[model samples]
Target: MSLPADLCERTLNRILAAHPDLVEQETPLASLTSPMSPAPVGSVRVFKGSAVAKVVYVGLVVPMIQLDSHMIFAFTPEDSAVPHFTLDSVYGGAYHAFHLDLIPRADLASHLPYLDAAFHPLSPVFESAAGIEGLTPAAIGPRQRAIMSPWMLVNRASEEAFAAITEHVDAYAAHWSGLVDKGLPDDVLAGLADTDLAARDTAVRANIFSRDVDPVWAQVSRLLGDETTDAIRAELVANG
Candidate 1:
């Protein structure tokens, strides 16, 4: 599956437009720096996660960009919770956001066909190849495996963040189960369930969806098979 020629052109153009500096250098990930205040009209802050690249683009287009990081074992910043403000601070600002994971230059070449197939006008195809599901995670060609392994780890971290929340939910479920096993009265059990559910609901609505989870979900959906991904979305919706 080759990317549509036009989509390929557009994607390459966007990449070149975003990082004209790449033309002159092949710098390692460590060498990058966050732009200072009064940055470029459309500067980007790439937060490389274990498997995805979370791109925060700031400028006249959008206030900020958020996507999974592609860097291997990319460290979550200390201020990972901080909201990006570039969009709100500037007037008439909008952003185009997407995620990209590292692919070995070689694998990237072989997988280009599938990426071409996954081209979406609204979503860029830098994160993962499309139409390539059913290939075991390990069966991915070596070149792609090399590029994606780290990116997948970054993606794992994002998933782990949700897994952490799910862990708490699981614990809550277990606690409820224990109470039920102890033969608590139906009304009492119902009340306890309601209370816990209400608290989790509030936290998810006010914090998780609006802040952390939704952004990651959008990116993850693209990478995961539909059935698996939809189930995950159902959990978030139910919890939220």
Candidate 2:
């Protein structure tokens, strides 16, 4: 529970450093507050880079810091076919859940080079992380498998497990930073407009928009009201 707050700040700092051009772009969710307290329950911002894509982060933090929910997603410019980063985490009580990956624009299995570059470098670290109870290997379940690459780290972990998880988080950050610095290739950029890649990418990001099953929303709503919960969901999918 305590880790999510620090993780949120650390993740944002790492991303800003990785993409220096990122500016604080506002969204409708900033004004919304938790029904439980006067202070804003959550915030949404766009981190836009000059050369790379615009990355958006939606963070929800509780007063006692008992429950924290945050997601950081990257949306590439229309002309780039690169996979954008996706990192979502929720911490409450003795449990924590994680979803981290460089979501592929297309089928992950079809992109061997990208997988090797992103996942292979961090493969050795996975064994130690798997030692946790709820977390298995890289992936599981159909929906996760479809959206996340096989190299991604998706699991539910105990609070104690999070200490080790930071290493995995740092590894993913390094890979993402490298990708942001590299940009896309000429051949991929050339065909981007001709293909429906941008549309596909947007649709993929839309999955996080509603997220009806998210327990954080229910908790926030119980503390606040329906309006606050609805605002959080809408701003998550909103474009900068």
Which candidate has the top score in lDDT? Answer: 2
In model 2, pairs of residues that clash are: 35-224
Error of 1 at 187 (Å): 13
lDDT of each: 0.26, 0.65
Segments of candidate 1 deviating more than 4 angstroms: 1-176, 183-211, 225-231
Cand. 1 Cα-lDDT: 0.26
Per-model RMSD to reference: 21.5, 3.8
Off by over 4 Å in 2: 63-65, 132-141, 184-195, 210-235
**Per-residue lDDT tens digits of candidate 2, residues 1-240?**
367656756877888887788787666666547546678777777666665557767777775766687888765665455666778787766578777777666554555554565456667665566776555333345664666566677777767776568877887777667766785555544434445776776676666443553454666668557776676556445344
What TM-scores do the predictions have?
0.18, 0.77
Over 1-240, each residue of candidate 1 has an lDDT whose tens digit, in order, gives 111222222333343343333232121222222232233222222332211112222212212433212111111122121111111111111211222232111122433332222121102221333322321122223433332323221111122232222222223223322322343344433333323333333343243223243454454344333443344334333211
The candidate scoring highest on TM-score is: 2
